[model samples]
Target: MSVNEIDEQGLGPQARRSEATKRALLDAALADMEATGEASIRITKILQESGVTNGSLYHHFGSREGLVQAAIAERFLGSVTKGLAVFAHRVGEVGSTEQLFEVFRDELVRIGSPDVQTQRIHRMTALAAALPRADLLERIIADQGRYFDGAADSLARLQEHGFIRFDVDVRAFAAWFLGLSLSRLLSDIDPQLNPDNEWSEYTFRALVAILTPAPSAH
Candidate 1:
């Protein structure tokens, strides 16, 4: 596949789906979690669904919990990478920090799959549980940061072009932009407070108006 095609898909074809056995296991775990919720997920069920051996699971993921962590981490980063693909695609289109906000908004919409609500819950749960698991924390955070940095690179370009006004730190803007999109977890806290349409419209306009023109000099 073309480079963009690979990236647009998920973490590149190699990491995403190249490992037939490991991917099968991860996919089975995700499917199981989605169908019955994490409470009902069982290792036997995952093994049976994936047709991967116990030894293979242990070798690849270390244990049942390890498999679960890997599954959640992969799913979470997959959503992130999907959104980054959009920003990467639109890198040339950005003309302002406001446009970068539109990119952030678009990234959220891109990641907002029908199951995004479920995925958000799963992501939050995994992170909470990961607090005690250093290995899993490293994997999840590293994967997530990798993509955010990729998006930040795009913002840096816009700043160079005078679209994103000077003096506005691109890294700060990038991180804030990502956090706002990743706020699905917070949004899910209360239905009444989680109006996507109103929130989206407001952020788009707010972001544009927040920009100040570059200073002129004689």
Candidate 2:
């Protein structure tokens, strides 16, 4: 069978052996995709690198496209969960809302690019757009909404504590910050470009300038 014609469809594992193989293949795919962005991955390369037979892959992923989508979702969703958890914990830690916002902003700046956090956003958004009718696509939108809500909640907490500007809509600001961060993340997908040159303290300062108000104004 041609590498391109691998069977696509079926997560069911009737036996332990089947389950193990499936787990290995999926794990391999997730690792590969995370190392080399989803935009430029190939099933053939995956199989070659993963050392799994086409049938093994097919039994797990069903098709090349399905495998890619699953990998993308697995890799990105896992990252999103962790990111939210960190933000949530940090928000709860501070004695006041203002400190929470400051810490959050500092954390955002502290997170180095390629901003896998934002890369997941762009990756999944593009994937869902390409396949709008898919059930998974709807789930992706829901996931993004939750992500936005998380950001908004953090912002709201900050606003409540008098950190973020009360006059500004926290949700809107959160959305804008999310969008901008994702944009910058996707734009810097290639590492050949200088990572430090385009994004650094200056970039974060600009982002803070927009999302936050001056201390004097507060």
> TM-score, each model?
0.76, 0.61
Q: What digit string (tens of lDDT, one per residue) describes model 1 on residues 1-218?
A: 67685664466665664478898999898888776566677889888998888898898988788788888787778767766776788876877656766666775565455666665666667667667889878988888778768877876777777776677776676667667656656755676874466666666665565445556685
Using TM-score as the measure, the top candidate is 1
Q: Model 1 clash tally?
A: 0
Q: Pick the lDDT winner.
A: 1
Q: Write the per-residue lDDT of candidate 2 for residues 106-216, one digit (tens) a residue.
A: 666545544664555545555554464475576666766787788777667766766655687766766676556555554456767654456555556665566565566
Alpha-carbon local distance difference test for all models: 0.72, 0.63
In candidate 2, list every pair of residues with a backbone clash: 7-62, 8-62, 8-63, 9-62
lDDT value for model 2: 0.63
Per-residue lDDT for 33 in model 2? 55
